[model samples]
Target chain A: MSILVIAEHDNAELKGATLNTIAAAKAVGGDIDVLVAGSGCGAVAEAAAKVEGVSKVLVADNAAYEHQLAENVAKLVGDLGKNYSHIMAPATTTGKNMLPRAAALLDVQPISDIIAVESPDTFKRPIYAGNVIATVQSSDAIKVASVRTTAFDPVAAEGGSAAVETVDIVDDAAVSKFVGEELAESDRPELTAARVVISGGRGMQNGENFEMLNKVADKLGAAVGASRAAVDAGFVPNDMQVGQTGKIVAPDLYIAVGISGAIQHLAGMKDSKVIVAINKDEEAPIFSVADYGLVADLFDAVPELEAKL
Target chain B: MKVLVAVKRVVDYNVKVRPKADGSDVDIANVKMSINPFCEIAVEEAVRLKEKGVVSEIVAVSMGPKQCQEQIRTALALGADRGIQVETDAELQPLAVAKCLKAIVEKEEPQLVILGKQSIDGDNNQTGQMLAALTGMGQGTFASEVNVEEGSVKVTREIDGGLQTVELQLPAVVTTDLRLNEPRYASLPNIMKAKKKPLDVTNPDELGVDIAPRTKTLKVEPPAERQAGIKVGDVAELVEKLKNEAKVI
Candidate 1:
């Protein structure tokens, strides 16, 4: 079978989630083609060609696709996706916005956020906020699915050489216009891609007190995150939240501090290889999932932890 | 301008769901159900638009069993003018629900349609965008802020990286996010008044839309449990365990 894996990029570099998606496509046992749809994204297309499992890369460079708007990109995907057996993308915000529209255009039901590929037609996904795992089999002619990147190990970024082809299809509905964006600027690594992640919660008390965690994170070269409570309490922006509705990370090391582990927060970080929790409440549900637990006040523990590191 | 807001009745967010003994599905037999939180935000947004004199009327719609009408009434109590219940006993996926909504959209021809970004139950996050596609309308999903102007609406979306603002022409689809606005609780008088609001019921067959499942669930199982490890006494012991035992530091 031939599969089309949509590449997620910002015209300059390919996102790591695309690599993980490629790994998922490999597990589906198909000849994979990467589609890079963006204006002046030749560099991204070239990078996609180098991914180990990709057989080919299709570059659709046009101003209409510059911002990856759903109205325009969905039309292009719908038109081209008809020829493929399966169309897949990483379950990110961009993919989530565009893929379902394309699936509806094709009159096919989209299977979202699949965590395991049981077969070409069957997959396993999390439902009810990851509390239950459901195995679903698709009966549609062409399967459209989104891969949960954290569930799949990413393929090598540099290995193979694939031919790059230009696609001259432009389908702009012109019903919507991109106004602007405010992306977070961080010197540290991206949360989902980081190897080490340190997060705080409501127990952090206030926004300014996050400096203690930040100091430890800097020493460990880890990305910093916060719980839904912390975000709602105005301790951090929504993007920093780690929960069912926010970004899911499966880092090698996940350290949660002063966070009374709610089930929603656990859903995001329980998959980490190593989990450490420091909370004064010994009965905090987060300690149940943590590999190591410390029952101590964060105010005294955080400073000592930073100094120890 | 007329506005259409869609709501869903789901398992309450606070309830801890578990798989049944037979593993057929999550056992919500006696669990308390409520309006999905994001849909409440959608209804609140529509009410605010009406309060600002931008929306002339608000129509709240839901597709499910008879019980979903309760959610629609909740929306009316929150200031919606009327309600529509697309009653069905069939298990509706995102595509089928979108088809039913598309039929309603075609008949109502409202200036704007708003829905929750994702229900807490399925967490599919697809119905609004799929409905927009089926009706050939532009969509603004995961909306944090919405402003209605002449013939257009500007939506600030909550994306993975941060926020993005997009301007869609009228008759567009917008999905609500957590930060959109705080939903006001319904007063006792408003709850009583909602019973008098007009609520019309229709079936999917009357809309001429096929509501069939495209995917079959093989099984449903609980996630693997993570066991809690030993508790450390002090910061130095925690550091030692990370470095020597777990080697994760």
Candidate 2:
């Protein structure tokens, strides 16, 4: 059996999630090939070729795929779907946008956000806002799935020597056009890819208080995130939300500051290796999952925590 | 131009869900049922479009058990011109749901189709994109902002890194995110009027779509509960525990 792993990258470097997804692809036990589809992405393909255990790297660089438009990228991936038994991508926004469309075009069902590889066709995934974990078995001939990057360890990026093959480009249907992007410019790592995440809640009160978390984050080299409540309250943008309905992050360390630890919020980061909750309320649900709990106002505790770090 | 909105009936977001004893599904019996929160946002966006006179009419569609009509009525109360119910008690997968929506799209030919990014229950997050593929339409998934133009729609999407903007031709599929718009509550008078609104009922068989479960759910079990830990006296103790015991720092 062969596996086709879709690589996620900016023009320069591959996202850490893609390496983690390669780990998942390794678990499926196959001759794995990584596909780097982008415009002017030779450097990305070069980086993907060095990922350990990858046998081949297929590069589809074309102007039509410049912005990774779902309409265009899905067609490119679907056209290449027939060669592999299992096709996988990380459960990022780009993967979520493109995989289902490709699966539908292939007349197959797409298994989403698989956290565990039970067999080749059976997988475990979260359902009901992560309240329940469901084991799903796909009976289709081709298994299409998106790996929850946090569930797997990233493959080493420096060890492998795989050949990179350039493939013919697919024509853009011109049904949709990319109208530019507005990305949050941050020096810290992204929330999902960060080793440590510092998340604030409604208790932070306003966007101004988030600066305190940023100070702590900078000290710890962590990414800053917010609860859905904080996002709803406009304390931060929706892109920074970490919850059941938002981005699910499983970092090595998660520190919740003044967050009430709603079930929705817990679903996002409960899988962290270590959790620390600092809330004024002793009865907050966050304490239940925290390895270390501090019952103090975040205004005081966060500053002291930053100083100590 | 016409707008089509899809809504789903799910357990109210406030209710804490538990798995059944047999590990089949969540024990949703007697739980408060409501429209999926993101679907409500989609319905609200459609109603706002009709109010702006950009769309001539708004048709709400749902595919679920008979009781889902309650949600259809709720959409009507929110301002959909009519409702279509594809009645089925069997649990439908995302692909099947997309196929059913494709059948409806073939007949209605709405210039714009809106659906929630994912249902709160299954959280599959596939229907809208699959529908777009099955029907050969452009897609704008996870849209935070949407603007309809003469022959196309511009959508600003909330993605992982930040936000992305895209433009799709008319008759495209747009899936909503939470930040789209606040859904309005159905007033009492509008609720009463919704009871008089036209609701057409049909089934998957009638639409010539096969609604089959593509993936079998082997088991449903609650996640491992985390034991409550001791509260630290201050940040120093917390840092000590994180360093010595957890060793994750």
TM values, all candidates: 0.99, 0.98
Best by TM-score: 1
Candidate 2, superposed: residue stretches over 4 Å from native: none
Model 2 residue A156 lDDT?
99
Residue-level lDDT of model 1, residues B5-93, one tens digit each, is: 99999999999899899998889998999999999999999999999999999999999999999999999999999999999999999
What C-alpha lDDT values do all the predictions have?
Answer: 0.94, 0.92
What does candidate 2's lDDT look like per residue over B124-172, in tens digits? 8999999999988899999999999989999999998799999999889
Residue pairs in clash, model 1: none
Alpha carbon lDDT of residue A274, candidate 2?
86
Question: Distance from true position, residue B26, model 1, in Å?
Answer: 1.5
Writing each residue's lDDT as its tens digit, candidate 1 over A1-309 gives 989999999999999999999998998998999999999999999999999979999999999999999999999999999999999999999999999999999999999999999999999998888999999999999999999999999999999799999999999999999999999998888899999999999999999999998899999999999999999898998888898888899999999998998888888888999999999999999899998899999999999999999
Q: Judged by lDDT against the true structure, how good is candidate 1?
A: 0.94
